[model samples]
Target: MKNSKKLFRIMTMCLMIVMMMSVTVFAEGEATEYVPKLYSTAWALVPPVVAITLALITKEVYSSLFVGIAVGGIFYGGGNFERTITHVLNDGLIGVLSDPYNVGILIFLVILGAMVSLMNRAGGSAAFGRWAGQHIKTRVGAQITTIILGCLIFIDDYFNCLTVGSVMRPITDKHNVSRAKLAYLIDSTAAPICIIAPISSWAAAVTGFVPGEDGLSVFVQAIPFNFYALFTILMMLGLVLLKVDYGPMKLHEDNAKKGDIFTTGARPYAYNEDDGKKENTKGHVLDLLIPIFSLIVFCVIGMIYTGGFFSGESIVTAFSNADASVGLALGSFFALVVTILLYVLRKALTFKECMDCIPEGFKSMVPAIMILTFAWALKAMTDSLGAAPFVEGIMKGNAEALMNFLPAVIFLVGCFLAFATGTSWGTFGILIPIVVGVFSNDHQMMIIAISACMAGAVCGDHCSPISDTTIMASAGSQSDHVNHVSTQIPYAATVAVISCITYIIAGFTKSAAISLGFGLIAVLGTLAFIRSREKANGTYIE
Candidate 1:
């Protein structure tokens, strides 16, 4: 596989170089603004598509992302060698890395890692696990508690992903749940719950993008028809309640039951010994709860702070304008300080012991950090090539002909765009306006169409390996990133397929009651078939 990827890179790079040298200049023409032939065309989406496809196939995100970035540079640079190099370096990598928001997220990631390390060193995680093991006797209870915590943290997906994962990982681990399964749970709850929640950042983003309409009102109406999100919630409960497993997730879970939680030997993360040492036996349930609660409180305050809550905006308006990256970084930073101080005051860990966790936490987060940086850089390449405009054009161009099938079509488009770009917010931001323009407010399918758009974005982001929430989920669960992505994709894809069908039903019926009822039936029916098949094949886990 490595050799093939290397060969592919060599050939593609050579082809790009040859193309660069072979192009002819129009010396006869007067000076004009330079424009790449691929600009705003369907080809604009090719780079991200290539990246996403290769990442899934190769199981190597870094090289896949770089290849995609190079492809985008080729498209944008128009076969100019010097320009391609300059564009890839200056406009792509540096541009994204230098963005204040991106930097803030990286900082937050590192800080969150440090705090998690400190908590471990203080024995908070171990203590919580011991407590949960006694009270949460069944695996179903452990999974349900994780889901509930994830739902409660709906203010932001990133927050939900990390907080739920950190708090629940110990409990899940004790019950022999695979890290991959934990990641799937964290990820499924993160975006799916947030996208549907009325008071979430996702809600704020959706509202801000819809022009000339009351965004919140539309969001509220569309909630019932958000088949993907709602069905996903149902799917998770069914998985836990029925105690069934299928797909790649089943393999991991089966292995976990044998005591190999990871199912693979690839060691991406190095555990901190500070947490396991004999020096710290003073950990308590409050040691974990206080810091986690404090982090949540400070993070919320930080978000409102950024939105100028003190400066005069209403709560909704403030949320709409809040800088999540900045707020999270700020909130986590302060939260870390409070945790360290609390540990020191409680004599759980010395001041120096808490301070020592800073570097340890940073080390743990390095994998996620690298993946996020590359993903951001790749997104930048796509942006520079005008992928957003290209996507918007596709949505607008086919609207008239696909009117009856608009909801399904929009859902598919939303899935593809969000999957390629690894961002649900950006996908919806691009499509929501086009959907609005195509269907008037009075149109029967208008709200349904909008719901399809939101559902698809969340579905795509839920599966995309490069998504920040996905990355956060892996970090939170302390799972191998690729393992989490690979195992979760099948599960996410199942929900997406059912969701697409539900959208078709919705398009025709234009009624949430009929659409939602059929959607629920379809999901439950599919799961029953899977379970029966597993039992028939003698492969059922139980």
Candidate 2:
């Protein structure tokens, strides 16, 4: 097949590159703390670039990610076969899996998956869907509700993605909304909203990256200048209210109207098909409401508790210092316990049935976990190759020459770095400090640049196929991963381009109101233009 030939050729090229590098490594004896010759260079980015390109081209994730990891191992090991194997297995995969924070997130995902399964098995999802069908009459209402819920769960993006997806999937399905659209809604809102929300884990991460100044204060001041996050919100609302869907999203939306929610003909979560058949008829709306309410309450408590709220810290201070990984894991665990008890006590499901859902829940999250693990390992490879320093060096080297245009520059660099690394947080850690150091004397510009860094990072993360948030969104919505990525790129890129322009304006004008106002107008205008085009083409949904 043509596809097979292409893949074979790509693999051959990769092997050739590795062999060539092996010859080079043999010439230089390895040291204990062996650093790759390509470390802290532009070549450090090649691994992720390969992975992302291959994923987009092949529409396959696992193999593409493995190839990326292999490339990174080759680079890091300097193509020494044994070294590459050990680095890939020992220092890459095992390293990430052994991380406590990552373990916590995995545990949280499993528990949440279990809880969703329990909800479905108990017919909580069905009851809620039936109730929602009576009230939410239109597709627009369903989407708007999904957005509102996503925004409300701003404490953490991970929690936001899964929680909102679990709660709204049924409602959105009832209104014939495509899973891809639902994934987009969830992905767009998760990081974009959290990056702007002062109390969120994202804000905390952003603040921690700034060492010299008042981090929280700067974060608050930068909120208005975060054009991508702000404009993404506007774009979502505009797209929903105006009923505008373009690019691959339009195709998915069109197909969804014909009763096919997944246009790609791939059911990644096909195991969920039997959920309706097994639903407990006695399940009521409260079955869903009670578990979700408990989750939100406990998650907040768990987050603040980690931040020392119980040890006399203020709510704001606690939020600013919370460990989201530990918090979400702890919170989800207790919530799971409560949900199981509630189900058993109400006789909605027997104890054996509740126990059965645990592994099923874990099974549901396997795809997400695998993708996340590969992503983290790939990130580890990049880290070992010093991708952060490479980007940091470039930003620092160009900081002075482009002072006036630095915000725009920073935005683009942030976008590229985040897109390559598939991590907005890592991008923030790399670029924010550079912006702070460059504009230390110019407080106003400093704020704008920092905001631009965040906006760009989110934009890139939104677009990157390897991004964990994007992966989580796909998992949360039960949409095919590749379908979600392919459908959402046009939408995210549209906002990203507008945000870049807004950052440029902010860099010169130094006025949040003016820049944001221009951005809002630009977003609406672009959406309107797109809507008109779709309508003219006879592709617009009524």
Query: Which residue pairs clash within candidate 1?
Result: none
lDDT of 2 by residue, 95-203 (tens): 9999999999999999999999999999899899989989999999999999999999999999999999999998998889999999999998899999989999998
- Give the alpha-carbon lDDT of every model: 0.84, 0.91
Best by lDDT: 2
lDDT of 1 by residue, 269-378 (tens): 74643355633556898889999999999898888889899899988778877889898999999999899989999999999888888998899888888888888877
Residue 50 CA error for candidate 2 (Å)? 0.3
Candidate 2: which pairs clash?
Answer: none
Query: What would the TM-scores of all predictions be?
Result: 0.94, 0.97
RMSD over all Cα atoms, model 2: 1.9
The 10-residue segment of model 1 with minimum total lDDT is 21-30
State the TM-score for model 2.
Answer: 0.97
